[model samples]
Target: MKTLNSYLSETVINMKPSGIRKFFDLAANMEGVISLGVGEPDFVTPWNVREACILSLEQGFTSYTANAGLYELREKISEYLFKRFDLQYDPAEEIIVTVGASQAIDIAFRSIINSGDEVLIIEPCFVSYAPLVTLAGGKPVSVSTFGEEEFKVNPEILEKYITSKTKAIMICTPNNPTGTVLSKKELEAVAQIAKRYDLLVVADEIYAELCYEDEYVSMPSIEGMKERTILISGFSKGFAMTGWRLGYIAADRVFARAMLKVHQYSIMCAPTMAQYAALEALENDEDVLYMRKSYQRRRNYIVQSLNEAGLFCHMPGGAFYAFPSIKSTGLSSEEFAERLLLEEKVAVVPGNVFGQSGEGYIRCSYASSMEQLQEAMKRIKRFVQSL
Candidate 1:
């Protein structure tokens, strides 16, 4: 009998499962588990946003939209970008509404990469980046970032990794699993390198709204970058609409055209009701502000608790994750996370799942409720003390 696995695409088979989701799946069904593993907002979609989707259905706006998405939603996205980040994008030609930020990223890779071409990925990064690059027929090259540098990309180290085959670089700000937000100065350094090398940038700014201390800057805001950067963002993180599956990509006409071709044939359009809901999300900022405040509070508490517990954790500038080093405990990230879950019923993702550089650390999301976070921290403190 032929093995069914033999017929699957080798590329798909070779890809690693997401480290964040692996721990999360275990945590989900466990009784009395305090999960700080999944990177999702604890808040539900705001009433008005949900009502808008309901209204759309009531009005019979259920047909597939234009391949790029509803023009109104695209216009709202355009306005939101310009208003928030000072970015200028053409709604008609540049933006494509996607199923989610995940899909937006996947299709962007499909748009620009060819077989054997390399795309530089910053680490520790979202687990999806490497596998998607490979699926798009591009090689995934990692440029390491360290905790000492606050995990910001160092231009010198990045330069050493670039080669003749490098075609693009993928970056996530308010980065997943590590709440590091690149500053304007940091981004400028990266922009200079990309400009000099003429590398296309795939900027995943899905967590843009969650930036703390400093305002988020779009990579395309940099000089000479607008034409070469494909910006991927979505309402999932900021608007707490993960199940809504609404995201979009903004790029130059040349790049947008290529992505549109793939999206057109592969995914005809984003959901009609979700598009209506997204418009409501865009027009209002109150729900976003409320959630950001909650996350910021949790972030501070988690970082302080981790450090006080004798785990070395740095304060993150954005997002809601607290990555603490467990190196002093003399345990690998996976071992520590597994033990913590079983012993304390507290769930955190092992950082090594993000990349090799993350091996000594674990990622703890602060997106849970204050009470849950407080309880998790208490359990973690006891667990560390036991070691």
Candidate 2:
């Protein structure tokens, strides 16, 4: 009569559930709750992408693709990368379509991390980074970025966290939670460190298409970085295909070959129809432009509204989230978020869930409709005033 729990993997057991989903689930069960918790886009998948999937199904192309994915899709990805980001990768040797960017990230970790290896994770970052590193038998060392610096990674600070055990560094730009996009100068600072230390970089560029200001800088495009950088991205954020679960990874063939073995065993291939849909998504940039413009408008309104409401939000440069300081209210992030939800019927994620640097802040996604965002702003102002 031994407990079944005794046989469980301690790694999985100790991992906390996603903080984003925690608020999302709570909001789901409540009535009339306006959730700004999740980072999903409000836009529907473009008609062309959806039609491609339908066409694929109609044509009975429903079999498993190569473990690496369809050759045509991989080729299109290579062209899209070069065209959009000035990145170059060999389609046959360096690209692997994944179930999602989440999977792309996981396999990248597994491919490079060894037991007791340390991967420096820049924070406040996506919640999955640390856990995936740990699950891959590596240590996740967090390098904190603060609001004072607008959350951009400072190379001096980043280098301090490295050690003999450090194997790689994980970065998400146009970062989640905090919408700071790293400029080329900022990236070059980091690139210098990586080269000096000979460290690998896992760059999560899922929000590349959503950058608000200047052109997006791809890590691989940094001088001398393509050979050591693993580029992870997908259709989830910019293309509004989250449910389709399509993503891909591009790297030097040496790195890609290692990650492919991990993807091959765990995922086999990304969904057949989804691959076709993503192919269509890459063929056109008009839908992406339309959605990015909408998000930029929302970003402006939300940042302005939050600051006026006394929450002190910095204008995010990319991605659809606004991380505003709730320290003014003298409430812990969790306390503020919980009470705000209960009192005002508005839901947002507590920033501390992302990393310790995020404490005293909260993340509000501006991806909802204008009507909903306007109302959410009003309620948030009222809630702040009440305190």
Q: How many residue pairs clash in each candidate?
A: 0, 0
Off by over 4 Å in 1: none
Instruction: Supply the global lDDT for candidate 1.
Output: 0.92
Cα TM-score per model = 0.98, 0.99
Of candidate 1, the 10-residue stretch with the lowest lDDT total is 15-24
Q: For candidate 1, report its TM-score.
A: 0.98
Question: CA lDDT, every prediction?
Answer: 0.92, 0.94
Itemize residue pairs with steric clashes in candidate 2. Answer: none
Best by lDDT: 2
True-vs-predicted CA distance for residue 15, candidate 2, Å? 1.5
Task: State the lDDT of candidate 2 residue by residue for 113-184, as single tens digits.
Answer: 989999999999999999999999999999999998899998888999999999998999999989999999
